[model samples]
Target: MKNMVKRYGFNVEASLPKVPNHPVESKEWLYGRTIINAVRVVMKAQDVQISIFGAENIPATGGALLAINHTGYYDFILGGIPAFVRGKRLVRFMAKKEIFDTPVVGSLMRAMKHVSVNRAAGASSMEDARKHIEAGELVGIFPEATVSRSFEIKELKTGAVRIAESANAPLIPLIIWGGQRIITKDIDRDLGRSHIPVFISVGEPVDTSGDPEVATQRLFEAMRTLLDETRHSYESQYGPFDGGEPWRPVSLGGGAPTLERAKLLEIAEKERRQAKRDAKKAAQAGGRRNPVTALIARLKKLIKK
Candidate 1:
């Protein structure tokens, strides 16, 4: 692991040519058909089965804001494939800038006319998303900003609602289950599992005409419900949540981290911290060597005696 980490240390900041964004046009439908069909072929080869529901809830035409729960790296494909295949439309996702900076991915995203967001650049991407929305593009966003380590829906960012309101587009809540177990940020949890069944549930368009904060909360609630339903659906077909839990780590067949292991880790961490503090205190006491003051004190003591 250490060698692999070191080998790939410099790739993130490696120099890559800038990729320009392509404007959405009539040809996009053709691109969507080709790309989505290709993805389905590949997934079929891997024996990956996908079940998508509420797809008709997506607006057949015009722009819409897709608020998705990010699970793992394959989330884009998982979310995009179902939407594209069902709706016969491509969703322009607001992806992280790093993806747009990578060599091949950057080119593909630009070609797909997806918006690139540099989190540190503040709200600059909002305007870009709004522009795409105004152009009648189905603009999708993973509102969690990043995948949650626990496989649970994390707090959503307000960007999706803001974009929806600004573009006067309806906000559609989407939930994806079982993507996290395939690949995850937690190295110990990732088993590189394939042939897993993934489920996607799309909710009706959420009204975003109200306050952005309120609308965002409403979206989160809807997404949470959809996520629960999707998880239940996944488990119903697969089996128990213990050994085959979709929300758990891949190591435990995707079950959540064990409580006993967590408790043991906590105790060990506390002991290590306490030992470091005690060692620091001992060193401070041992290093108290003020020779001049000690000599003067001893002479004064002798005179008094």
Candidate 2:
């Protein structure tokens, strides 16, 4: 491992390019730029050495739907690096509504013009993404809908193909490996100078002109292939998985859960969230049925009459 690290690891200072002074039309607003600059500083401080491959596949001009695989919370940030490197393109990611409801982070997400998706009312968010793409903006979406605890490609939602077909944009498959080492599900985070080697790969735009189901399947296969290649390269350079590394996937003989187990965990999580929502709604209903509240309502109606 030491010899491989010495031979293959990169120096952060040498890997990153000089920050570009993006033009106003980039649509990276003042707050967005500030957040991105801060993120750059944080990434540098953490000594993250990112290697982006096939960045040229990201079109220099026009709308593109980046369908990225999700493994960790930082996937969104790391996944955007390729587009930025390609042509200073800022991707408007479609994230969950819970993140948008967050206090400071939510404000920043809005300021960055990210689209918020409500799982129950997702059409609005899809429409928002379509508009962004139609206007020649790059849009990013995690087709898996949530982080894959297995560190492998999960079954994808059809939103990626649907949005691309509707907006007449190219759907690009992208994958990021090694960000899971910094932060991921069921693991403690190490935000220090870990010098983690992060890998990002972009594949050619997928053909979304066909049936949505078929296009989604093709997109999934493309991402899975890209992920397999990236993971193999990462293990070759920085790993000889001893079958104990929590960050490595089970398929690679590491400690992460298998896809079947991860699916069960996701279902459990969804049920837990549903229970919480049900409790909250019941409490609200009980409040509305309070005798004092009912009396006030009746009095107001009588007065109006």
Candidate 3:
């Protein structure tokens, strides 16, 4: 497996500490552990080199809110590694409801106790996350809500700050770099063994008890700074960025769109989706009102009888 210690700069192979016998030993489930093990196997097969910094920033125990910047699909998986390294602490990430509605994956998500958020009715999911944190469990939230096509931190939602405040939990800021190279929005997938280097950085907890807007802005700045530093370090170790790298941000001279352009693209995509939904509804309504179609349906029912 490429020598876990040598390949991965982080010490994820270390033996986990023994948890005291209790009703909920470590608050971890067997299914979740199996999933994580499978992920590890996949990572090994792909030879992903993971480097973690500031893992100690993750609280060893108690309720904490992890506010992460979303850059790629794998950010959710990589973001939880720090807490796992710190003390095998499993994080219940708040993901969109569509993912929770999938077949096998949905059931696994429930078994892992991850929170599902319906964008139209997010209050219930937010409350669910707040309760998880209040119950002394670590919960993760992508403040950006979606993967940034520009490879930069997007305008963050205030839900993170509000949840932290309500739960009286520590708000931890984190960022992941290089995950976009593996798989991201509007990019070709690369699931092969490319030996990609993924960096995860954890910043100190932010104060969320203040004004929600102000706190969210502060959290944004913290995440931005962390991302910047992580990007610089990645560039330094992996050789200088020679402009036009799709996985790099425009600010760093990459081929990715600028923040403003990316926003425009996102708006256009949203409009297109809305139009498609409207058309589908209109077609369904038309079908119900079609007399000939209705007659065929009635004849079929009579034949069956």
Candidate 4:
């Protein structure tokens, strides 16, 4: 806690005078600025460069629903960045009950005015989100609900469309590519390569009235199209996703280590260790020098001549 204060100033929980229930109130707090700036600082320090397109599509005011594809744990920050930078709107995202119940994390979530959803009873939180939207706040939802290992926009949930229709809010599609490369669910922890490029492409708001299934489909296609366009733009400027697709799952193109692959790697490492032990024991018993090292020394002596 003290280290966090020294690094990022007083904890957001301590510095705020009053907790914000709405986005408008939250944005006015110094805590909001602190968290946003902290994310920016971390992104910069990790060399995570962000590319944003179609930011003009975000409405400057009024209630809006952002439907962003979920790719990784860090994706919410990426999903919210375009809105934060362009529209200056603080997006309220609904988190699962488990996350919202965490001690430190829950405090931060409360400070940020994020809604907490009960996994078993999601409707209550959905109602809360609808109310926030009706109050003219920008609400963001990861319709996928979980990170997509395939890196492709997975099938989306109807919660976002339902919220938009209920609140009469415009549904804006947000697509983010390459965030999983920075960190993925496959590994316990992977501080990925520095200067990794993260692409965010926002699309025009879609109609939310009428059938929500159709609306959800439209949003999915829009996000898919934006993802493809962002990929093209990224590759055109930088390069391909190397020999393996940086964002895709290994089965697709992501090349992230999988459970089966990890197991094989572990076995191989154990075999190598056993072989080393066997070789050392044999050397000790026979009093034999390391042939490879002896050969290198002999070569060095001959070169001196």
Who wins the TM-score comparison? 3
What are the per-residue Cα lDDT tens digits for candidate 3 across 14-78?
A: 33333332234244555346766777888889988887777768777788999998888998789
The lowest-lDDT stretch of 10 consecutive residues in candidate 1 is 1-10
Q: How would you encode candidate 2's per-residue C-alpha lDDT over 228-296 as one tens digit per residue? A: 998887889887757878888877988888999989999999899999999999999888787988999
Model 3 lowest lDDT segment of ten: 1-10
Residues 1-305, candidate 1, lDDT per residue (tens digit)? 01111110111111222222223332465356566667666666666656666666666567778898887877887776434533356788888898899998798889888899988984899999999888888788989886666566667788888888989888899887877766755434443336667777778888887788888889888998887777776667777655755456444466555445434544676699899999999999877858997799889999999
Task: Tell me the spans in candidate 1 whose CA falls farther than 4 Å from its real position.
Answer: 1-30, 187-194, 244-246, 249-254, 257-305
Candidate 4, position 226, lDDT: 84
TM-scores of the candidates in the order shown = 0.70, 0.86, 0.88, 0.72
Model 1 scores a C-alpha lDDT of 0.70
In candidate 3 the C-alpha lDDT for residue 228 amounts to 92
**Of 1 and 3, the candidate ranking higher by lDDT:** 3
When 1 and 3 are scored with TM-score, the better candidate is: 3
Cα deviation of 165 in candidate 4 (Å)?
A: 0.6
For model 2, the superposed segments whose C-alpha errors exceed 4 Å read 1-27, 287-289, 292-305
The lDDT ranking, best first, is 3, 2, 4, 1
Ranking by TM-score: 3, 2, 4, 1
Task: TM-score winner between 1 and 2, please give it.
Answer: 2
TM-score of 3: 0.88
